[model samples]
Target: MKKICIALDYNPNSEKIAAIGHAYARALRAETILVHVISEAAFYAMEYEPFMGYDSPFHLNNLDMVKELEQGAENFLLAASLHLGTDGIKTQVLEGETSDAILSFCRENRVDLLVIGTHSHSVLENVLMGNTAVKIVRHTGIPLLVVPTKMEG
Candidate 1:
């Protein structure tokens, strides 16, 4: 594989995924790219409607908020890189729907393999809220290395 992409989120279990993904990348002698996609809901968590002369409590404007979000995501990828203790790994911070962003990036970058973390979800929960890993699996043709990040009961 020439390039391997690892998708990371804010979930704590992402650390495990990163570790295993990096090890695999090293073994394959492939270039690694760590990607973090910031969903719009994550950036705009508050719902507010302004009435006559009403102002939103959020101090930063939308543009500033987006900048902050991007910076935070960059820091996250950097921390993951540091934790992996590796050099020459590329990092990308994308904006949009999580799974779509990841898949598009992989396709555009011609990533040979995608590494992702999967959370344990009950059948009902899976139906109610579709999982990103599931969505990727259904849509992408790239090879995947899904790390199970289920917490112990």
Candidate 2:
């Protein structure tokens, strides 16, 4: 059976990507693996902090924060799996660079298709903030299905 990997970033458009994965899997009769990559670096950098020694309390606090964020990411992925389960999709959670992890997982699992969600942001915004979907598309060799977030009515 063919394998499909759907990379979920826990964004507002996650459900739309899940739906696209569901439709694709149904049409292809392939197994779906929902992958969520939690970047510890990104999570930690979001908080401002002053420089501290290697064994300082600030370092420990940041480590704890990263652990909590990882746990939250895992929980989110679990909840997503349960929701997508209603549509018969399997899910998995991972931690690392979002694009690199997804591509590596696809290569390891021999995935034929990858699904991702894209936010509608301006070029300048994307240049400043970066886009995971664009990075994944550039790095992966397999076919990708990008589900753009719907505009609010």
Candidate 3:
């Protein structure tokens, strides 16, 4: 594989995922692209709930907040790229449906391999969240490596 795209999310297991991707990239002698897809729900929640005390509807109207989120996502990817410890590592932040965005990126970039982290989820959580990993697997032609965060009981 000449190019590997690592799908990242804003979660505690993200650093671990990056480490795994880094190791795989080194072993394969592949270029790495760290990608983070921002969720619109998360953007509003971060701007409105904690900071605005959930009082103002202004967060929904705030374009600046969306821009801020884009910047933050880019910064997060940059930090992850550094953590991967490879000069060939690149970062990208895209907004939209997570799985679709990731799949499109892989297709457009000619990625040979796709890597993502999956968390163990309860039945209800899986039903509600609708596993992005599964969706990506169903949709993408690229080879995928899913690194589980931990074993479930």
Candidate 4:
């Protein structure tokens, strides 16, 4: 395998996922890419819009917020790469639906292996929000390695 890609989120558990992914990449002598996606809703929320006859107060016209987020993602990925002592680690910050962005990136980049973490969500939340991991698993042909959070002993 030449390329391994890991999808990262804002969750702190993502660090653990990155660590495991890095170890596997090293074992396979493959390069790693850390990918992050900014959801469309988040970007749109920065602007003011009336909803239910009331305007949202959290409005800001600056698009620099998105840029900041991208920068943050880069830094986060850099930190993870350093933790692994792995060289040539690439990072990408995309804008779109999370699962779609990840799947599209893996396919377009011809990634040999994909690594992701399954969040621990309540049944109600999972049912309402749907699972990004599950969506990716169903739609992608790329080999996936899903790293789950370590269970308490």
lDDT of 3 by residue, 28-142 (tens): 9999899999876355645545353456764565676677878999999988887766786889897789998899888898999999998888879878989998888789887
Q: List the residue pairs that clash in candidate 1.
A: none
lDDT of 1 by residue, 60-121 (tens): 37566767888999999999998898889999998888899999999999999999999988
**lDDT digits (tens) for residues 54-106 of candidate 2:** 44343456777777777787787777768766555676767677788888888
lDDT of 4 by residue, 1-153 (tens): 999998988888898899888888989999999888878636544665678888654466445665666678778777777876767899888779989989999989999999999987777987999989889989989899999874557
**What TM-score would each prediction reach against the true structure?**
0.88, 0.78, 0.85, 0.86
lDDT of 1: 0.90
Question: Which candidate leads the pack in lDDT?
Answer: 1
Task: List the candidates ranked by lDDT, beginning with the highest.
Answer: 1, 3, 4, 2
Question: Once superposed on the true structure, which residue ranges of model 3 sit more than 4 Å away at CA?
Answer: 41-54, 57-61, 151-153
Going through the candidates in order, what is the number of backbone clashes in each?
Answer: 0, 0, 0, 0
Q: TM-score for model 4?
A: 0.86
What is the TM-score (0 to 1) of candidate 1? 0.88
Off by over 4 Å in 1: 41-48, 51-60
- Ten residues in sequence with the least summed lDDT for candidate 1: 40-49
